[model samples]
Target: MLRTGAQYRDSIRDGRRVWINGERVNDVAAHPAFRPLVDIRARIYDMQHDAATREVMVATDATGREVATGLALPYAKADWYAKRRAVDTMMDAFGGVVSRLGDETIGEMWSLHDGAGVLTSIDTHFAGNIQPHIDRILDQDLFHVSANTDPKGDRSKRPQEQDPDMLLHVVRETDAGIIVRGAKYETAAAYANQAFVKPTIANWGDAKLSEYAVGFISNFSAPNMKFICRAGFAGRGSVEDYPLSNRLDEIDTLVIYDDVLVPWENVLFNRHTAAAAFIRSTLHRYAAFPFLQRILRFADLLIGAALLNVRQTGLDKQPAVQDKLVQLARYREGIDAHLIAAIETAQESPGGLCMPNQSLLYTGRLLGCGEMHNAIHLARELCGGQICVTPSAADFANPETEAWLNKFYSVNENWQAEDRRKLLAYARDLMNSDYGGHRLTFHLFAQSPPYAQAGAVYRNFDWERSAGIVARAAGLSEAVDGRKEAAA
Candidate 1:
């Protein structure tokens, strides 16, 4: 089902208790801290219905009903391409990067669908719950997010040993369902409608069964839920000076679930440690594609900013600057090539759904996310010291400094003082600001940490192929090829 932008706005105004900077937000949709991102999300909903964008953003499902392409199960490489194009369209429309939007989060459920066999082994009812929740996302056009990491008090001791509330566990099972109490660090939960809550990463250590192993769908508007958010970047400063921060800061939140109830149907997996572990292992299998795509756009932003800065200053004529620009281009296209090759060699999942080639997707994630800081620093260097030392918009507007600032800032007829000021301001927001640092950390650890990302690359890489090639070259035994045995 397709929802108009108005319906999307009305849905989040359900009076979900939200707090930012210790102040109660009466309406998240209009609050300064949230309005920018909320408006961006709402515009995406509108894009699904807009005449020019609808074709890319909306697709017909099996029932012949048009639904958001982000929520649709990816059935082929074309579906992956469509999802990528839609995200690019949204980023182009909004002129900034905002990850954790519904498109990126819905793929978490697709990972679960691929692991339904594990759920079936634990409980058939749990297995039955996977697809419908995904369908409900499309049917209601709901905004979805994922809740995985919890503020575990101490890693040294288990929840059973220390405070049990550290990890979200099933408090007790009622006839209706399970009551859960815990907090999750979710980035986009304030304006989102629901989340797929699961155990914190690798929290269930060596336990065959535990309450902390539970995973369920959470309704954001449910009673006893509260969204306590960090100080937002939007209301912190002038939009002219901090354009990206004011418009694209996706405020992270510590969402407290004060003994909320989850209906039986909403309970995805109860007291199943293996199922929980299975999910943690393959959580980003499908989702990482979209996540990597965001990084690619960010790379473009970096390269574009650096390239323009050099051109404005006439430094592009020099070979040293050109070399740095080449490095940035290589980084951007490295990620681009990975995405293309991943789709080109897309693999069919055990669930019969087509997913990007696991190795390329994961290695691409590492390249895109791991080297983002270096890329940003390169952009920072290319943008020059002016990005950090440039006067604010207010200072530039001052009667005392306007003439002097313009005289210095203006490079040529093509590059005026105001345009130069805007570029520096944009570069500062993208590189040197608090929002910039947070985004760096977000790309570093948002999907998982660097070790885990490398671990995924390790797990998915075809070690046997390399080994088989060496064995054949060395005239080793046929026993080295597992494929031959399988063929027989």
Candidate 2:
């Protein structure tokens, strides 16, 4: 069932408590800070119904029911291609990148669905809940997000030793379901419908039973849930000056679960440390594909901003400037190559779903996110100092300063002052503004930190293949192969 834009907006207007900038937002969809993203999300929903986009955004499931293309579980290379095309279409439509849309978050459910074996081994009842929820999201066309990071009060002290609520845990079980307490740092939680709440810390450390090892689907509008969001960047400046921030600021929230209940059907895994550990290791398996795709799009924005600035100023003729542009192109294509290569070498998940090549995907994530700062710096340098010193749109329009500003900002016949001002303003927001800095930090640490990214690469890479090659090259003993076999 494909949902329309109005339906999607109505779903979230359930009077959920949402706070931003120390004020309670009565209508998140109407609030200036959130309205832009909310409208974008709504437009994405509407795209499914629009005749031009319906074919690209909607697909038929196994049951012959039409659903959002992004929510459909990928079964073959064609399915992946369809999802990729759908995402590309949406990004093109929006004219900017915005993650945390339903497409990106739905993959978390697929990751857990792949872990049905682990879930079943722990408890058959737990395993039964996976597919139904997967169907529920597609059928209802709901917006889902993820929750993992919890405020671990002290790294050295355990939850029992310090504050028990530091990490989200099962407080107690009730007739309906289990009640959970604590919080999670979630992006788009205020506007999103549900979240796949789970443990962020992977290590259980020999304890067989732990309340911390719990996973469940929590409704965003449920009782005791509070979405306290960080101040938004939308209303901070004129749209002409901070266009991306105004339209693309995905407000992160500290979602407090004040003893929220999770119905039995909603609990994917509870008090099962093995299942929790499995999920933590493989949580981003499918999700990271879309996550990395966003970075690739951002790379395009960086390159475009830099090239436009250089071209407008006629600096593109310089060899040094061309080298910088080439470097930016390489960065963009590097991410693009990884994405295409991963899909080309796609692997089948244990649950029979097609997953992008894990090794390539993880390595690409590290490359895309880890080196984003350098790319941003290069783009910023290429845009020159003009981006920072450009006067506001108001100054250009002001009768007192318009002529003088125009005289200085205008470069040539084709390069007018208004055009130059707009380009610099865009470049600033993309590379130098508060929104730009926040985006960089998010790319750095959103899907775990740099250290964890390295760890994922280590865990997924084919070490045995390398080991066998080195053993043959160096004429080493067969012990290395034996050790690899033993490790496997």
lDDT (C-alpha, whole model) for all candidates: 0.90, 0.90
Write the residue-wise lDDT of candidate 2 on 1-488 in tens digits.
67888988898899999999899999998898889889999999999999999999999987889999999998887887898889899989887889889788899999988999888988777788889999999889999999878988998987888989999999999999999999999999999999999998776788988999899998998999999999999878999989899989999999999999899999998988888888889998989988999999999999999999889989999999999989889988999899899898999999999999999999999999988999999999999998898889999999999999999999999999999998999899988999999999988888999999999999999888877777777877654463465576
CA displacement after TM-score superposition, residue 265 of candidate 2 (Å): 0.8
Residue runs of model 1 more than 4 Å from their true location after superposition: 477-479, 482-488
lDDT (C-alpha) at residue 301 in model 2: 92
TM-score of each: 0.97, 0.98
Candidate 2, superposed: residue stretches over 4 Å from native: 480-488
